[model samples]
Every structure is written in structure tokens, then in C-alpha cells.
Target: MTRFPSQTPHGEISEVFSDVFFVTGSVDMMPGFRISRSMTILRDGDILTLISPVRLSEAGLKGLDVLGRVENIVKLGSYHLGAHNGLDNPFYVDRYGAKLWALAGMEHKGGLSTDHILKAGGDMPTRDLSLFVYESSKMPEAMFVLNREDGVVIAADSLQNWSEVDEFFSEAAANAMTKGGFIRPANIGPEWKRHCAPAPAEFEKVSKLPFRHLLPSHGTPLLNTAKTDLVQTFSHQFS
Candidate 1:
């Protein structure tokens, strides 16, 4: 049997909105360097979907069970599997027989593979959600727009709102990230911009989405004001 990454220190999953939950966790970047990351969970009746999943503790698994069965695992970022300790998708798939979803061009590193290919206009895990793809990015990067409570945007690397350094970040990692200009509120992911170089028009289309909340893979949830709060970021990056 292939051994997958073990569960690391992560906070308990907590409800951020109606049926949306998030868990803050740490990613091992290198030997002793670690940084914060997050996973978004969505519930529709008894079916649960995990987006940009983080390996959880035994207790966390039990908590997840109480909510519903893990039926779907969604990957919204092309580079998500590259995080050293963030490779937990197969664990869920093997354990619960869950289906994995990702964009067509996303790299399946470390023997990771997807069960479904998500597109800009195609089937989604749920009916109330719609997909948006970054057509200009070198790698496949996408976002989910949930059509509920006005609107909610779920993203991986395209958007972020770190707010502040949290427990998941080691001291050295935190300092380095701050210097790298990643510890900001309502900002485009610095590294994603440098690597992906998505077209400005792509974000312009995102800005027009009806989303009011943002559940990012690497930052705190920006509720209600997700769209308004990112006004300057969109302008600065695009303009």
C-alpha cells in the first residue's frame, strides 16, 4: 500500500456559513518550515464535498462523519498537490470511496488523479454552484461561486485574505511570508500571480460575479464584504 502524508496539527472544523465549514491547518513547506492553509467543506443533505482538503485528526474525522458522508473531493488549484504535507485527497478517496474533481490541465503530481474534469460551463458537484476558470493561466486554476445567501466565492490560490498570522504558521514561515507580502487582507495570492500570471481580464470577470463572501484555501473567511473588500486589489492588479 502506498503511504500518504499523515495528519498534521489543524484546528477543528467550524461552520462559517449555512452549510459551509472551514478548517485551518498547517502545510510543511520544507524540513522545518511550515505555513497556514485551509480546507472548505460543503454539505448538501447527507453528501459532503471537501475542497482543497487538509488531512484531519481522528477526532476531526469523527466530526466530519457526524455531519455527513464524504462523497466528493474537489481540487480548485493546479498547484495544490505540491504542498508537501497537503496531499490527503487519496486518503479520503480510499477510505470513503469518494470521487475527486479537478480542472482538465491540473497536474496530477505524486500519483494523484481526478475522477472528474471541471469546466467553466459544465456539471458541478452541486446545482447551486457555478464554475469559473482562469483561461489565461498556464496551469488550470478555477473558483466556485455558490448561489446562496446572496453569493459565496470559494477559491484556492487566485484570491486570498490572510488577515493575520495564525497558529498554523511557524515563526520563521510567518516572518518570511510577511516579507514576501503574503500576509495581507483581501489580496491576490502573491506567488500565484508570480507563477500563474493570470490575465487581468480574468479577474475583471471575477469581479463581476455576484459573490459577497470568500472562502479561500490559504486565509480567513471574508464574509459579507468579500467583493467590496477586494475592490482595491482587483484594481491594483488589473489596472
Candidate 2:
């Protein structure tokens, strides 16, 4: 299994404002293997609620800057808050960001410092957006829930990425991810399990969605039975 390097290319892809219009970009892997990163922009006129911004270049930053007023930004997970430290933007971190806020200190990228701390009601105002907070830890990993009527779930590191994580990692890294509480073999670890656990209950919450598609932060967006495959894979590991 060949490992693919990170290829988000740093830019704005698409956005969804409150008016029911959606815009996004495609993230890809090497050659035929590619994927797209997502940044949700929920807007009410000049007010923009940005999801996670990618590693954009100078020009890409210009494009992202041109997109909207971008008042408040939200980071959905620990890893999702990647290397854009110098970005002097206001950020709101739900439970996930609060858990990983210390990381912003290590590298000078991502949600450096901003107004508004993350709290429970974060999802209520963003009702048009989908919200999935899987209990990955006491800190919890943030999973983006698409507020679309379709009900798709946009997962960051929780679902990681197939192409981003090679089959080799799935085999060898399983032990490490298992111990680190990110993933497990066949079944999942109690630490990062969904809806904070018991598996079945997590399955129930996921099943309630009318959507079958998955938009992951890395690799590719999955459709068809990929959703079921991922669920079953995680379920099998539940102990």
C-alpha cells in the first residue's frame, strides 16, 4: 500500500450559507486518488460562520479572504485544526478545540486566539448545519453534521481518511491508534467510540440520518455503501 502525502493545497473550496445554497471544493490524493477538504460558511448576509479553513497558499488565502466577511470560525476536531497558525481570525472551538487548544501553542498555525469559547449551544444557532459530536475522549472529537435536508455526516479525524491512511497503517498502525484511542482492530476503543459509546446507541444516532454519504477531511468523500461499511467496521471492533 503506497502512502499518499497530504494534498489539501490550502484554499477555499465551498460554502453553505443560510439561504440554502452550497459551495465547496474537491480534495484529492496522488494521481487518480484524490479528495477534497470542506469549509462550511453559514452566513446571514455579512455574518459568516466558517468551519475549518485548509492550508491555503498566498493566492488561496486571497480567494478565501474574498469569499465573505467571515466573522466567526469553528474548528470541529483536534487534527482538523491543522497548520494555519498565523491566521489572525476569530475562532470558536466546541469541545474539540478546547481539548486541543494547547496545540496551537506548539505550532503557530490555526485558531491562534479568538473571541467566543465553545459551549453546548454552539449547534443550536447553526441548526442549518449538521452536528455530530462523537465522544472520542473526555474532550470529545467534533464531527461535522451537514445541516442539509439530506443529512450527510462530515467527519474529520474520527473517520480520518482511507487514502490519507493507507491499508498499511490500517494493519500496522492499528495497534498504535488503538492505544492512542483513535482507532482499534475490528472493534473500536472505548475512548474514541461514538456518541460516547456502547456502540449500539452510537449506531442509532448515525442511523437516524436520512443521508448515506460521508464527507471526510482527508482521502475521498464516500458514497453508496461506504457509510455502512465504515459503521460495520467500527461496530465489529466494539467490545
Per-model TM-score on C-alpha atoms? 0.95, 0.53
- What digit string (tens of lDDT, one per residue) describes model 1 on residues 33-67? 78888999999998999998887888999999999
Candidate 2 per-residue lDDT over residues 1-239, each given as its tens digit? 01322324433354332332222333432344333444445555555555554434456545555655544555555534233322222222321132222211123244255344344336333455545655433334555556454555655445643433333232444444445554322223233344334435665565565666565544345555545766776556553
Candidate 1: Cα lDDT at 26? 79
RMSD of each: 1.6, 9.1
lDDT of 1: 0.85
Clashing pairs in 1: none
Residue 197's lDDT in candidate 2: 40
For every model in order, what is the number of clashing pairs? 0, 28
lDDT of 2 at 206: 58
* Top lDDT model: 1
Best prediction by TM-score: 1
